[model samples]
Target: MLHSRFCCQWGNTLSSTLLRFPLADHKKVFAIALPMILSNIAAPMLGLVDTAIIGHLPDAIYLSAVAIGAMVVSFIFLLAVFLRMATTGYIAQSFGANDRAAQRQHFNHGLLLAVLLGSAIGLGSPWIIDFAMWIVQPDTQLIPLASDYIGIRLWSAPAALITLITLGVLLGRQQSGRAMWLAIITNGVNVVMDVILILGLGMNVKGAAWASFSADYVTAAVGLYWCARALNWSPTSIHIKFNALRQYASVNGNIFIRSLVLQLCMATMTGYAARYGSTVVAVNAVLMQFLMLISLGLDGIAYAVEALTGAAKGQRNPHKVAYWCRLTLLWSCIFAIAYTLLFWLFGPAIIGLITDIPEVITTAAQYLPWIVLLPLIGHWSYWFDGVFIGLSLSKGMRNTMILAAAFGFLPLWWLGLPLQNHGLWMALSGFLLMRGVFQALWLRLRWRQII
Candidate 1:
């Protein structure tokens, strides 16, 4: 009889434990991730379109022009990505704490920083362009075309950064759906303008850059309106508060370090790739799209984890935070496996679809198989970035990234050089592996602190 009673109590405990899972919250999490995934996907659709449109142009000139133009712009705008990351963490935490005032304050802080940074970028465009040109050392023929594209596109830096701030603020508030809507609007307009200017008006590279600029400005305007309405901006609240600025500065300072290191790593990789001949650079450009596809897809789940974990931490619920970390890893593995399978089976056909250049197509295809390995190895840092960001451990994030970039990326790349074209692929793969391994190890040791 005692044995039977013990068994009954044990079964009851097990059942209650199973029942404690947060199904509704899990569903809500997926709801946020779905739109976020679409937005993430749409974000890269522009790059794919640019490649397709410019690839079929009269020559490689237009394609290379787009590549250089877009890369320079990406390097510039990605600095503002911290706004989104910091905002998401801060806002999610405030949401968890049920602090509406804090949310409002964080949003305003983000806007102030955005304006300050955006204005600075606008004012420095001329020197920035010249510096970028000097570093990349474009061929004589392509320099004029690239310059034209950069000149017009840099004019939109303020709008682009403003959009970054808006997206960051919205993501912080857990308004993933709204962010998706805004991204779709921006991308859709950009695509239509590209078709009109490049295809309809026969404007070539200039049209492509202008289309992007116009789309950014339009999106910025709409975003400004949405943010103002959401924040209940009245005469009393129009000016940002000093205390809010202090908090924002503290959070963003750490994140800025994190963002800067990531940017440097990316810029370093692409810069090294450019040191090779144009054929290799073109091939790397093609491969990067696939890499972006995988990373961005995985990033959806990571972003979800960031929002959920940040909120959980803010609420002082270690159990919930732990649950989210486990769930994120599980989902990440599933997506990783699915992407690997897709790339392995269809990589050649996908590469063929991007460019008609026989050389570019062949080179990209040869390197495509290596990409399958990325989903397995590359998904970890993408996920862990969100994990640390959620826990507000941005300083650790900054340090880890810098270490990985310096120790892992630079040395391996330097050693892999004898292989030439193949070495670039090997080096990039090593960089991704190092990021995953280092971040995973760090997280393993400090899981308690993070949770």
Candidate 2:
């Protein structure tokens, strides 16, 4: 009887302990992670919807044009994604330190940078569009349609950058729910506009662009309001210092380079896929959405890690940093496995459901296996990228990405060109593998020091 009583007491004590730490940690992570997951999922839903809608259009060119156009836009915006990354690190650090002043400074700096960069991108859209067109070698049937799509979508640069900065600040502040709210509202707006203009008004690809622009601008406004409310940062409190800007610029510059390399790799893949032909491009584009679904969903977890790691780093708490890394990696692997199985089992049905093109469906099914395998390679790099960003190890990420993209992935592509379209898939698969291995090796070595 005494022993039984002791066991009951121990069980109660263990349950209470879990209520305090590990269980609480799980709750905290999911509170932040769930909204981010939803937002991340919603952000790409527009593209999938677009591809689906365009697939049923008169010919495959509409589908191909949207695919190529979207990639061009993504590459352009990715060049500035550092705004979001830099903001994430700085804000996370500030939150950790409990320094509202510093956090406000980071937001201001990121906002200013976004404005300047957005203006530059907006102004150069024509030239940039032309350059993208040149590089992709858009055929006559698709060029005008693709050009129109780009022309309309370019207007969103300012709003998109601002939105990105807003998201960074929110995520850094652990207000991912607000971020998720913004993404949902924005995507909802985009979908309404997409349907209205595409089906109701018959604007074709231009309708899609207009929808994106309207949604982004509206969301940017919402983001600004949320930023003001959440940060309690106002014009009266805004302080800009040259030293702060310089420090931010330095970190941001390195991140920009790292992100640029990443985007270039994506652009190369899309460009080469375009070279394969419109049918292939359409199939690849649809399949690419599924990839984004997996990657971005995982990225929400990565962002959680980024925010937590930055917080821990700011507090000089090495154990916390290490804890976050382990926790994030474990969760990421679980999600990766789940997504892999999801794609493997239902990929064909999903592809067919999204489009009416039989050839596109067949081609995408053939490539689905690689997609299934990518999360294992791609998920970890994303997690590490977040962790490294939190530590402000931008140069490390930049160097590794450069090496991986240049020496690791590109060479494999060059060698595999003889395999035709299959070669491209092989190259992409090789790229993800190289990134996973390279980043994993780097993290294993540097984890002790960074944490």
Candidate 3:
């Protein structure tokens, strides 16, 4: 109905931008998305490398500790992901409006927030790890090992958070090629470190933590250098505008709550997995790497949609927004289908690739069907997330996630308790589906301005 109305109201005339030159729009999508896909792909590859190296250890407990530790460290990043999302949305709008001053404001504010937050994380690393330990409550043996891994990894929080903002600015500006290279720099260094520190040095879990810690600084340095080169950026020039700070808090707060709820579900998953047993925890971890791999790869399209829709929203062009949405939706479905098929066909082999543990591979493959179904359930939400972010609409994003978690996931998780791990997967699947449904409905309700 939204598509129909947009066509009737502003048809053909909008073609000059997308309709007239469909291939150009296609080219634009891939230009932004391809690099993003490569960049996103490298991230999960790093995770796979981490899992693979840790899995080769003689005991499964090391794998469990690192997995749990990685989740905490990465969840911190996820919680702080508000920095990148808000910056990308705001900067994309500024880019669309050709408002250089606003662009600078968004970038500087994001940079400042990153530094402050990153520093806070660095100072609070011990407390954060301690809190995660309390909440997740892994087996007694895993507590110390997970703590060591989380502690070492959190040392680089400042750099990691800063890099997050940098990537957001790059993606928002549509300098996706540079963003891709930045990802390559961060993740490539991580992969090499995994090989050297984890594999060669045999530092076990500590090696993985150190690998992630070192990569953050490398990434932050390169990211800052690029910022300096492109924008003549410097900390000394940053002006602390009270109004801008207020705006950042207002917008970013909702985004933060939204991320918090999302991570809560993730944390719950890990927590529940721990209760299921150490084997289940490792299985969940192994499986999650693939889930993230699917989502991040699909996020290429979502990020493209965010940028384009943001630009469109800035320009007040309903037709452009609608056109880009349609294009993104097509690609989202295609990517989802491809991921489903790929996982369905290669799930066991891939699990085997991550861990040599016979039991982990076999038990993990039992739940491979859920992984096969996740891309289909989850991709649309990723698409709508782009739409909301592009339009600077965080409240909708927050509301949908809460409803999905509270109404869709929690109840389902409770009722299916008897099914054990499969029940957890069922609840998780419902969560993603509910999010997509809620987001789609919200988009429809907001169609006029969105289109």
Candidate 4:
């Protein structure tokens, strides 16, 4: 559905206002972005809580084990993130076109796909878990603890995927406030569980895993309620057409490839970081949290771009689409600059809050400069991701990411082996910057055609 539209210069019916380039309304951006920011913060806030709890433990191995273990589960969940992203795009367009039926159809398709993929991941967890652990090859002391954490968390695969779809619908409909609440509630539950299981009961790594598992299921149930109420939809009305399913799958398949590369980059980063030992990997883990904060916080702007740009595209209003693309990029830059200042100012203190280990703290502080550089360097790609997702330009995303990872990050990392961790940071920064550069080139070259 999307590949054709983007490639063929979309021929959908245009609203009469298509020619009018009205002034950009900043309110529309905030209306969608603000709630998402809070919602986006919740997960990282959970990570911070998890890290803080695990970091304070007597041994660095406990912190290291949980970090590696959570990475494994995050890789799995990240792979399936398309469920939310594709649903949001499709639903946003439907909402814009005032097509209730299309919205419902997309929602149903996302639900069906979620169940199948979730079930497959659950059944296949044993092998995936083994493979992930094998790649990282953590310290022997950390392996058992990590496996226990991963093993417990993997059980929530189905609920986790379903949660993606429910949240997808909320965002697609521009119901970001609802999405925010859903994220807050979900992470709040995880936070509480972490406190009880890790601090109170002294379960440590397993406790963090269980907290995540329980929170996911709760989110799935609650998210469905929100989506159903908003859409006035129910299970009994679930009707999926073969054509619709095919389109959904096609749109998401490209996303899957892109996501696979993303997970690969992350897994490789963690695996290599593990080679340096506990303190280094723990440092990497903490730094990754800062990265997540940047990405997710910037996601507020990106999500807004996806919904509004998608809606504008659906209305066949070239002027509005252009307006959105420009202003959202402006907002993204502002946000990125803000993060750059925040990290530079308080990064060490934040790292201090996470873990009390002097070695890990010092090692992590050494990398704060890279974290400071990231928001600005990598934010363009994040902003463009929203544009691509909204426009259903997944193939472009897939190609750019593959190119960035294969030609940019991998080669640079290989060439910089002498520099060690510094090399890894350079490669990552290069990878992110390359992605944005490629996408920007594509969009710039195709501006007239796509619009």
C-alpha lDDT score of every prediction, in listed order:
0.80, 0.82, 0.85, 0.86
Model 2 regions more than 4 Å off: 1-21, 46-71, 136-152, 192-211, 274-283, 347-368
**Compared with the true structure, what per-residue lDDT tens digits does model 3 show for residues 1-451?**
9999889766554454354447878889889999988877776667677578789989999899988998788878878888889888988888888887777778788877888888888889889988999988899999999999988888788888788788877887788999899888877888889899977998888888898889999999998777666665677767779898888877888999998998888777767877889999999989988877786668889899989998887787888888888888888887898899989898888898889998888899889999999999988888889888888888899999999999878998998789989989999999999999998888788887544
Question: TM-score for each prediction?
Answer: 0.83, 0.83, 0.83, 0.83
State candidate 1's TM-score. 0.83
In terms of lDDT, which candidate is strongest?
A: 4
Which residue pairs clash in candidate 3? 318-451
Clashing pairs in model 2, backbone N/Cα/C closer than 3 A: none
lDDT of 4 by residue, 262-354 (tens): 878876777788788888888998888888788767888999999998898888898888889888888788789889999999999999988
Q: Looking at model 3, which ten-residue stretch has the lowest summed lDDT?
A: 12-21
> How many steric clashes between backbone atoms does each model show?
0, 0, 1, 0
lDDT of 2 by residue, 82-198 (tens): 888888888888889898888888888888888888888878888988999898897888888998888878878889999989988888888989989988888788888978988
Candidate 1, residues 322-361, lDDT tens digits: the string is: 8888877777877898899989998887788778899999
Compared with the true structure, the alpha-carbon lDDT of candidate 1 equals 0.80
Q: Look at candidate 3 and tell me the lDDT of residue 436.
A: 92
